[model samples]
Target: MKLKTYDISLVGMFAALMAIGANITSVAPFLQVAGVPLSMQPFFCILAGLLIGSRLGALSMIVYALIGIAGAPVFAGFSGGPGVIIGSTGGFILSYIVAAYVAGRIVERSQNPGLPSFYTASFAGIVLIYVIGTTYMYAALNFWMEVEMTYLGAWGIMSWFIVKDAAFTVLGAVIAPRIYKSVHRGARLGRRSAA
Candidate 1:
């Protein structure tokens, strides 16, 4: 479907949310696993997917990445620039797009994806995020950076975020549908008023 002004705004809003989520303190430990920092940005990424659906959700993530790469201090720990995108944690950053798209696609395809479906979809998306991120991390470390990290070693790093992300998935499953319903309800009201 074509994007309306509201959809565009939501996309931009989620993009901004990604930035804010990345930089927010008290979210997660600054602890590094295999040189990657544990960050809660995935929560917002999955939230965007649930709230906005697939196309816009992925677009939102792309916007977030591009803005950060363009020198906005919008990444985790207030870090940004192409350097961050090419850094060790960049795989996870890029994986947000795929995670959002997959999660949103599942929900959008459903007649009414309630909490259980959202949880399942989001959990799948999270798994995809880890898979893609870890693979990329392995390649980047071994080939690009000459760091010599094995594939299994890369996945080992993801252990730090799995439990936390599982919790966030549950939280997103609960909160996203409520927000989605409210937004759609408002949209319906607005349409009726305009008509």
Candidate 2:
């Protein structure tokens, strides 16, 4: 599908949301796991997918990543620049695009997607985010960083985060459909009135 001005605005909005989600609470020790800071990027990323569809959702994530890489200070802990891409959490940042696309693709497949579809898509998104993020963190730590960590240990370190992300995923699924319905209805009415 071709992107219009409205789609571009939505993409920009989600990118801004990603920035806000990243530094929502600053970089507190309690919010960190294995030196990686926790952020709501997944929640917003999945929401973009649910609300806007796979292409625009992935586009928004790409915009967010690019902005961060350009030293916009839009990343987690208010840190940004190309160096962050080489950092441990970079995989998570990159995973946003994949997770958003997958999540949106799942929902788009349904003729009339309901709560079940949303839940499945959101869960899948979260799974992808964790899998990609954790794998990259493991490699970054063991190889370049000179820190030893088993694959299982990497997964174990992210257990708490998985729980937290699971909750946010459910929340996104619940709210997204309602918001989508409202927006769809409004758009339809606007067309009818215009005609």
Specify the highest-lDDT model's number: 2
lDDT by residue (tens digit), candidate 2, 1-195: 655556777799999999998987674457665655667889999999988889989999999999999999999878999989888889999999999999999999999989999999999999999999999999998988889999999999888888778888999999988887775565456556656
Q: Which stretches of candidate 2 lie over 4 Å from their true place?
A: 27-38, 185-195
Model 1 weakest lDDT span, ten residues long: 26-35
TM-score of 1: 0.87
- TM-score of every prediction relative to native: 0.87, 0.88
Cα RMSD for candidates in order: 3.1, 3.2
Looking at candidate 1, what is the lDDT of residue 81?
A: 95
Cα lDDT tens digits, model 1, 1-195, are: 666667778889989988877765535555445555545688889988887788889999999999999998898778889998777889889999999999989988889778877887788788888888888888889888999877888878767678777777788888887888887776566556656
Lowest summed-lDDT stretch of 10 residues in model 2?
183-192
